[model samples]
Target: MKHALILVALLGLSVTAVAQTVREPDGYRMDQYRGPVPDSLTGGRVLDPEAAHDLWQAGEAAFIDVLPRAPKPKNLPEGTIWRDKPRHSIPGAIWLPNVGYGAIAEVTADYFRRGLEQATDGNMDHPVVIFCLAECWMSWNAAKRALEYGYSEVYWMPDGTDGWTFFDYPTEVITPEPEP
Candidate 1:
C-alpha cells in the first residue's frame, strides 16, 4: 500500500508540472499590440507588495515600475488647463515605461536596454523588483528580459500598483528625465 501511494504521488507531481507548462499566447512574450496577459512569466519569482516593501526598506532590492505614460489629451478647448497627471509608483521605484512590451520598435528596444543598464549600474546580480498595473504584461516581459540579461535575482510584483495601494502603502511621485 505504501508503494502504491508513492506511485500515485509521483503521478500527481508529473501532472502538476505538465499543467504549469507555458502555453501559446501566454508563452509568446513579444506582442506589441495590446492583448490578453499571460498567467505566468518565464523567469523570476512572483512577489507581493508587502514583501517588496520589506526588501526596499531593507535596501536589498531595486524597484522598477514599467507602466507606460498616458498620452496627453489632444483637441482640448483653447482655455483648457493641461495639468499633468500625478505620476506615482512604489516608493523608490524607478519608472521605465517603454522596456517591456514585446516586439517593440527598435528605438524602444534601445531605450529599454539603456534604461536597464542604468537601473542596475550594469550589475547583473542586483536584486531587482519589477512591477506594473495588475493584469499588465509589461512587467512580466521586463522581468524575463532582466533574467535573460543574467541578473541573478529578479522579482516580479504581479499585484502591481493596485496591490500596493490596496495595502494603504504610501507612494511617491517620480518624474522620469528625458533621455539624453
Candidate 2:
C-alpha cells in the first residue's frame, strides 16, 4: 500500500515538473506551476498548433470542424441546427459531427464511413485530422469513428476552433452542407 502511495506521489510530481517546460507560441513561457488542462477529454491524440498548420498546408491531412449549430448560411435564411456533423468542414476537412455535447460514446461507424468516403473520394487512404470546440469530445468521437472505419492515419486535435484560431489558422464559417 505504501509503495502504491509513493508511486502516485511521484507520478503527480513528474507531471508538474514536465509542465514547467511547456512554452506558449507567443514567446511567453507557460507557467511551470500548473493544475490540469481545463476541461480536457482523453483517448484522442493531441497536437501542437504549428503541426496542425503544416498538415493543413500539405493537404495530406483533412480538417473537420464539429460544431453543434450556428447562424444559418445566407442562402438558408431560416437557418438550421445540426445533430450529425455537417460536410462544410474545416477547409480541407469534411464536417462530421460525431456525438453531441457531453456524449459518452463516440460517433457511429457509419458517420466515419461517410466522412472517409469524402476524405478518400479520390484516394483510398489519407491522413485526417478532426477537432471541435476546445475541451470538447465531438472531435474525439469523430476521430475514433475514423479509426473504426479502418483509417490508418487519424489524428484528434481536441484544441478545437479556439485552438485553431489561437494559432491563427484561416477558418471559414459556413452553413452546414446537406448530407448526400
Model 2, position 93: C-alpha lDDT score: 54
Query: After aligning candidate 1 to the native by TM-score, how far in Å is the CA of 84 from where it should be?
Result: 2.8
Cα error, residue 85 of model 2, in Å, equals 14
Candidate 1, residues 1-180, lDDT tens digits: the string is: 677557768777664454445443544366652434455555677787899878878988878888877666999999998876777888877888867777677777667667767777888788889888876778888788778767878898877888899988889998764554
Off by over 4 Å in 2: 1-45, 70-89, 98-111, 122-124
Candidate 2, residues 61-180: lDDT per residue as tens digits?
A: 777666655433565445465343343335655555433333323333445566566766735467767777665545555565556556667677756667778866777755443444
lDDT of 2: 0.55
Q: Give the whole-model CA lDDT for all candidates, comma-separated.
A: 0.75, 0.55
